[model samples]
Target: MRYDLKVPFAEKDQAKKLGARWDAARKRWYIDEGLDPADFARWQPAPHDASSAAVSAPASRRAAPAGSEGTVQVGSRFVELPRMCDCLPWEDCDACRLQAWPK
Candidate 1:
């Protein structure tokens, strides 16, 4: 329910006066839940274009085909590895260790 804002650096003071909160973790400005988005219309991100192709997952985290396992060369033998989850590169779900990496 959070609403992220796209306030420009030059206008950060303006957004602050309008009650936008800074999210250090995400490095973006946002209005709290229950706040009316109409008041922050100018900073809102552009609407998603439906005509553009949707991204299923980032390439590094894309899962291997069903019933197949990926193998990596380990010294002398090939080691089979499980498919990875399709979580966002910036965020981690319960299954991945993406949180360990620096943002």
Candidate 2:
């Protein structure tokens, strides 16, 4: 399933790398976490088992599709959410650096 996503600024363009796709039937988008934007830009969802209606994204994928929500590497740990601010991390810092973090 290739579902389109409306990524909030927090998620940043990293969403672009995930190649988030829209699932019209589910009316929600999906993202693949394993994908590193610096390298690739697309992926397809596993075929849903028709026998079972439950949709299960990998634990890592489900935990955080976008790093903005904070990130978990390999999903062994989850980083804390960034603070609220004009920048992506929402932290107080040189506007110059923050602006470059993500947008």
- Give the range of the ten consecutive residues with the poorest summed lDDT in model 1: 49-58
Question: Candidate 2, which segments miss by more than 4 Å at Cα?
Answer: 1-18, 33-103
Q: What is the C-alpha RMSD of each candidate to the true structure, in Å?
A: 14.3, 18.8
lDDT of 1 by residue, 1-103 (tens): 6777888899999889888888896677888776788999888777683212212345679887776677643666666555457776566576666534445
> Which residue pairs clash in candidate 1?
none
Tens digit of lDDT per residue, candidate 2, span 1-103?
Answer: 2233344546545655456554567654554454343332232223552312225565576664555676534665756664544555545578646554776
Report the Cα lDDT for residue 90, model 1: 65
> Which of the numbered candidates is closest to the native, going by highest lDDT?
1
Best TM-score among the predictions, by candidate number: 1
Clashes of each: 0, 7
Model 1: residue 2 alpha-carbon error in angstroms: 0.4
- Per-model lDDT: 0.71, 0.47
RMSD of 2: 18.8
